[model samples]
Target: MATYDPFRDLERLASSFLETGRRGPREMPMDLYRAGDHYVLSTDLPGIDPGSVDIDVDGQLLTIRAERTLTTDDSAQWITRERTGGTFLRQLSLGQGLDTERITASYNNGVLNVTIPVSEKAKPRKIEITTQDGQQQIESTTA
Candidate 1:
C-alpha cells in the first residue's frame, strides 16, 4: 500500500488552478524590455484580428483588449466544451517615466508590438563634471 501526501496533492491542485487562470481573457504572456530610447512590449495574440484589438495607455497603466469569435456547428450528438472564445482584456502597469502621448503600437501577423518612448527626464543624459585637475567626467542621470 502507498500513502498519499495531502500537501503534495494540494500543491498540484493549486498549480493546475493557476495554469487555468492564465488562459483567461485578462491573462496574457508578455515580454517587456528596454530598447534604446524606448521600452518595447511584445505580446502573443494568435488567432486575433488586428481590427478587433484595442490598445490604450492611461496614466501609468497600459490596457489591451481583444475579441476573438469562434463558431463550430457539428451535426453529431452533444459533446464536451473546453474552448473559450470571447473578449479578453489585459492591463499592465508601466513606469511613470514613459511618454504616454508618444506611445506607438502596431500589429503584424499575429503579434502586437507596443513602443513607449521614455520621457526626456527619464532617459539617461550625459552630465559633464569638471574635476580639480581640470579633467571632465561624464555621468548618467535619470528621472
Candidate 2:
C-alpha cells in the first residue's frame, strides 16, 4: 500500500490554481509562454495605468501590485454596484531556469508584457561527436 502526501500535493495544486485562475476577479491575468530562449508573460490590466503598477522580484518569486482609484460626481448615484475596484496583489514563483536580473517588462495597450531571459545554464545545448582515430568527442557546449 502507498500513502499520499496531501500537504505537498495541496500546496502544488493551490499554486497551479493561483497561476491559472479566472480573469477580472483575478488581478492582472497573465498568459505565459516559452519563446525560443526566453519566457514571456503577458498580462491584461484594463483601466490600470503602468505607473500605478509595481513589480517586484525576490529570489524566484515575482509580485505585481497595483492600486486602482475610482471616482464619481456628487450627482451620480450608484443604483447597482458589482465592479469593486481596489488594490490587488499577485505573485508567482518563477522557475530556476530564468535569469531574474535580465528580466524585461513593458506595458502597452492595456497589457503588460514581461520577458524573462533564460539563464545560459538553463538553455539546451547540442553536442557533436567527432572521430579522432576511432574516438568520439564533444563538439560544443551551450546553455
Candidate 3:
C-alpha cells in the first residue's frame, strides 16, 4: 500500500507551474577564458548528438546551437522524467582584435571547445626608437 504524501503532490504542482510555457530554446552552461594569444570557450552538452551541433559567426557575433532528443518506449513504465530534451542555444558578442576567420571548434566527450586566435595587429609587439644621433634603440610595447 502507498501512503499519502501532500508534500510530494505540492512539489509536483510547483514544478509543473514553473515549467509551463517554457517551449523556447534552453540555455547551455559555458566557460570562456584567455590562454596566451588565444581564447578558449568550453560548453557542456551531454547526451547531445555531435552532428546536431551548429556554430556560426556573423561579424562580431558568435552563435552556438544544438539539439537533444530523448527516446520513449510505449510499453515501458516511467517512474520519473526529469531530464528534458530540446534545443539548446548560446550566443556571445566577440570583442575586437580577434581573428574570427581563423576560429575553430571541436566536440569531444560531450563538451564543445572553441578556439579564437588573436589577430596579428592586436598582439604585443616591439617598437624601434631612433635617437638624435641616428642611433636605433629597441623598446617593448603593446599594440
TM-score of 1: 0.66
lDDT of 1 by residue, 1-98 (tens): 98989998788678666655765565557888998889899888878888999988777888999887767677756344444467777798987778
lDDT of 3 by residue, 3-95 (tens): 999999999878866664468899999999999999999999999999999999999999999999989899989776777788999999999
Candidate 2 scores a C-alpha RMSD against the true structure in Å of 12.2
Model 1 Cα displacement at 10 (Å)?
16
Best model number under TM-score: 3
Best by lDDT: 3
In candidate 2, where is summed lDDT lowest over 10 consecutive residues?
18-27
Error at 2, model 3, angstroms: 16
Instruction: Order candidates by lDDT, high to low.
Output: 3, 1, 2
Model 3, runs deviating above 4 Å: 1-9, 132-134
On the 0 to 100 scale, the lDDT of residue 60 in model 3 is 100
TM-score rank order? 3, 2, 1
Where is model 1 more than 4 Å wrong at Cα? 1-24, 74-83, 128-143
Among all windows of 10 consecutive residues in model 3, the one with the lowest summed lDDT is: 13-22
The C-alpha RMSD of each candidate to the native structure, in angstroms, is 6.6, 12.2, 3.1
